[model samples]
Target chain A: MEKTYKVEGMTCGGCVQSVEKAINAVAPAATVKVDLENNHVTVTGIEDDNLVAQAVENAGFDYEGPVF
Target chain B: MEKTYKVEGMTCGGCVQSVEKAINAVAPAATVKVDLENNHVTVTGIEDDNLVAQAVENAGFDYEGPVF
Candidate 1:
């Protein structure tokens, strides 16, 4: 499964890498990609929304949950 | 003067950019650089601590004031 989230406060490549690392830690098999220009992060191979959210927060960014 | 802040929630380049922009908006002359590996942001040319904090929060990240 795949999901997209609108993360606020991402402004550079470092944020892109941070979000990916954080999510990957929570969902090891998940492939994470961040569209910094859009402030959205897409994760594949993960279905647990709560876990993803937690990881996002833990990583120091605001995760507004999957974008509809 | 220069100040180093320990900001929480920065995870990638986007974060670095966001923080920089946020701070710059408040202190246009401020030179902001974020070290993702250390989760720290160094700002030069600005001296208002409260303003910096507000900018960080407004940027969606926790700004724990200049690192002692």
Candidate 2:
């Protein structure tokens, strides 16, 4: 399943890398893309919302949970 | 001079705090505010741009220099 989440604190390319790393840490099979302008992160192959949320939080980002 | 900088990697309130602390560390008298909506940070009371940039970088953030 794919989920779109609202993440906060990302301000650049490095930030995008960090967010990707954080998400991949918990779900190695997941693919993440960040929309910096919109503060949205779309992930594929990750169904556990809590897992993704925890990863984002542990990386010091604001995870506003799954978009829908 | 009051300067506004394009900062990257700040995604949350904690990030804002981190940025503020980093700036204050180098210039204790300076004031820092993170504009998450626009990825901009406006600072006052610090005349040295290099000092502020260094502080932000050392804190693991991307400092894109002053806006104007």
Tens-digit lDDT track for model 2 on B1-68? 67899988777666676677667877889988889989899999998889888777655578898887
What fraction of the correct interface contacts does each predicted structure contain?
Answer: 0.30, 0.04
Candidate No. with top lDDT: 2
Chain A only: list TM-scores of all candidates.
0.94, 0.93
Interface RMSD (Å), every candidate: 7.6, 6.4
Q: Residue A43 deviation, candidate 2, in Å?
A: 0.7
- The alpha-carbon deviation from the true structure for residue A58 of candidate 1, after best TM-score superposition, in angstroms, is 0.6
Query: Each candidate's TM vs. the true structure?
Result: 0.53, 0.52
- After superposition on all C-alphas, the RMSD of every candidate to the true structure, in Å, is 8.6, 8.2
The CA-based lDDT of model 2 is what? Answer: 0.79
Cα lDDT tens digits for candidate 1, A1-68 = 77899998767665666677767766779998889888899999987889888777655578897898
